[model samples]
Target: MATKPRMHLALDFSWTQVETDWRQPTSWVNRFYPDIGLFEDVARICERGLFDLIFFGDSTGIPNTWEGRIDAAVRRGVAWPRMDMSPWITAMSRVTSHVGFGLTYASTFMHPYYTARLLNALDHVTNGRIAFNVITSQRKADFQNYGYDELVEHGERYDRMEEFVDVCKKLWASVDPDAFVWDPVSGIVADPAKVRPINHVGRFFKVKGPLSVPPSPQGRPVLVQAGGSPRGVRASARFVDHVFGAGKGLALMAEQRVKLDEALRAEGRDPQQVGILWATKVIVAETEAEALRLKERLIADVPMEAVGAWLSHNTGFDMSTLPPRFSLRALNQRIVAANASPVGFVGLLAEQYGEDMEISRDEFFRHGLHAATGYASTKAGTPVQIADYLEEMFEATGSRGGFMLGHSQAGHRAVLQNITTMLVPALQRRGRMRTAYEGRTLRENLAAS
Candidate 1:
């Protein structure tokens, strides 16, 4: 009999329990935002479910785009008080063995050498279970924090990102993977011939010499990138081992797959070897009605001010200045003119509701409420039903990659528990998920059939 096709699964903790979900009755984030134990417990749960990775997406600045002030974001905890997460990931690593940790850093604002070295150390710390998610910071707030008066030009940012990864790759290869030779009698720590300097000079940066750290366990951390734009997609194809994609819908997902495949082939890389893990939000419960009821909590009690702050922050537009009514196409043009991301919430909205369609300000906020709370895209159902949706999406999107489930309602212990204890078991029973980890390293596991 032919082997049954299986899909890889990962848990995205980036904003799962954030955005007012912390205030929910079932959420423990209110009491455990910075608690090491909370993350440790999460890691343990993911490991138990045989999850491929636990991802963290980050930003370095507070939201000030809503009304040109930070009051709303700070007061409502829109995206403030964020920790570095490296140390937190380290703590989580100690409590789990097989699950991978994905750490994000902005290549536009950060130096390549430092990022390469930090990820190398983390790879060793995680025992080869580290993936590097490199991004180009597009938020005005993020740029300001990094000493920039404005956001980097869109195409240039990706240019810098491609060069940034190129430099890191060279630095990682500076010291040969087999360079270390711990000879007790000879008293030699490493082979002198194997260590070399990488004299790199490029459009974005210039660096000299070898990285100080030893070669990492996986040779280098698995390279991951999430770039939804055309330029961004091309950049991802240049170097990413796997992609972090948006799960807007089946048609869009399949379209993205085709685009990525074309870009990969242009880069002389095998498209089949690369995978795109679509960012998916799922809420699992004992019954469909119960799950739908829980999904309602995503928008419950979330104030309009907070919604505006979130939408403005993410789209890099001032929602406070929105006209009484406007078309999605016009709004997207304004966002693009301001050099903000052209394909975020606004782009998704344009795709869902016709770009030419004009919407009232009140209607916009109604959509904003759902988008801000992640209620619009979240799938709620019993384990069997949720698994069915995933299976369909998997098959529809070429079946090479799988889903990164989180960013909606997984913040509560009950919701997350339902995923591990219920949803995962359902997938396993259908022979669509792994029962045990078959690889020692994350890269190996992701590549496994």
Candidate 2:
């Protein structure tokens, strides 16, 4: 029998776009920031498109890495003033049933007990429609916020993440599914014997007790991760059910998936059971010419300054100080040794090009400086063309998992509108994407996909 073809689509929800993009009429500006209605509207649209989830990528600090100053980020609104995703997600859940919310919470700072209690409550509130995007934060400022003088080393961070997740897992499993008795005649709310303390003790965390809240409908929220480093990959393989792949382009994504699959095998897991969603940008229109024109405009409008600030925040290395002619080795050494960036620049280069390939400083700068602004992996064209690319990429990458759609500018109003109205319908007509959700919960929907 032939294998079935399907795509798991998600939206990248963040505040950076509304803050950074100054030219257009941003969705947040018109709709107002921190408004529940805005999130509800987007969630409703995502439900209409049968999108699996709306992922909220977050950071803990106001980045000051660009030229060692926070003014640029403040001035440009580049990743500053991040609102907590919990409230909006809760509100969105009340308005939509099928769509899931992928909420990011860093394990580096939060304790396992708190995380367990919080997510458990959220899962119940969302009716089992939540996915946790686990992140081992690497930004130095984020560490400072948590009272650490410096960010921990990359490998060590992952080490802690493993323990942190282990503690959370133990806590989640502490309460049995059938623990709830609710027997009025016997006057029993739950079986005390069924609920017990996990009493976990590990390298990074030690938790002793059962979670305060019971398991939601899906048992536990789906585990989502976006780790790009080798250690990060291993951690994801051990814990994640869905991986938000960090690399761009077909080859990069394929390479990431292969690495993840290898890790899964090492951990005694079937690769097919773990979903890998590639991060990509798309611009669709009624006509091919219109899409091409829009793509050009969006690309042209991408400010190199904004790109530099964004890079600084991601890598934790200031990109503005690099001279026209600089050494790639020096840059990589600084990034790695200082633990300046969350995802090392060298790691990214290896993902794009082979690890063994020799890359000059000039080539690195050319690629790194403006890379964020350009939609090199963009699916831009008419709805049909966009759908064709989605199907082709889906097949090329082992015919499973799918893309998490992102837009270049902040707010991303146009991209969301076009995708909901045009591209999603096109994919549905081709039988590549779903018209209606397959299950009530996020995990079930993801499993079906």
Local distance difference test, each candidate: 0.89, 0.77
Backbone clash count, each prediction separately: 0, 2
lDDT of 1 by residue, 1-449 (tens): 67667889989888755677888876777777778888998999899988999999888899898898999989998887787889999999999989999999999999999999999999999999999999988777888998998777889989999999999999999999888889999999999799888999988899996999899889989999989899989999999999999989999999999999999999999998999898999999999999999999888889999999989888777889889999999998888888888897889989998899999889999999998888988999999999999999988888887889977856888788899999999999988899999999999999986
- List candidate 1 segments past 4 Å from native: none
lDDT of 2 by residue, 1-449 (tens): 55367889998876535443434554455555666777788888888888999989999898877777787777766787687889889999999989999999999999989988889889999999989888988775688889988768888888888898888888888889999989989998998898999888788877788987776788888998888778889999999998888536577678778899999999999999998887777788888887777665554555555666667777877777776654455566667877765354556666556555665545665565445553554557888888888887777777768888874522556767888889888888777788788898999999885
Error of 1 at 161 (Å): 0.5
- TM for every model, in the order presented, reads 0.98, 0.93
lDDT of 2 at 394: 78
Clashes by residue pair, model 2 = 17-410, 315-341
Off by over 4 Å in 2: 1-3, 26-28, 299-303, 342-346, 349-369, 409-412
**What is the lDDT for 400 in model 2?**
69
TM-score of model number 2: 0.93
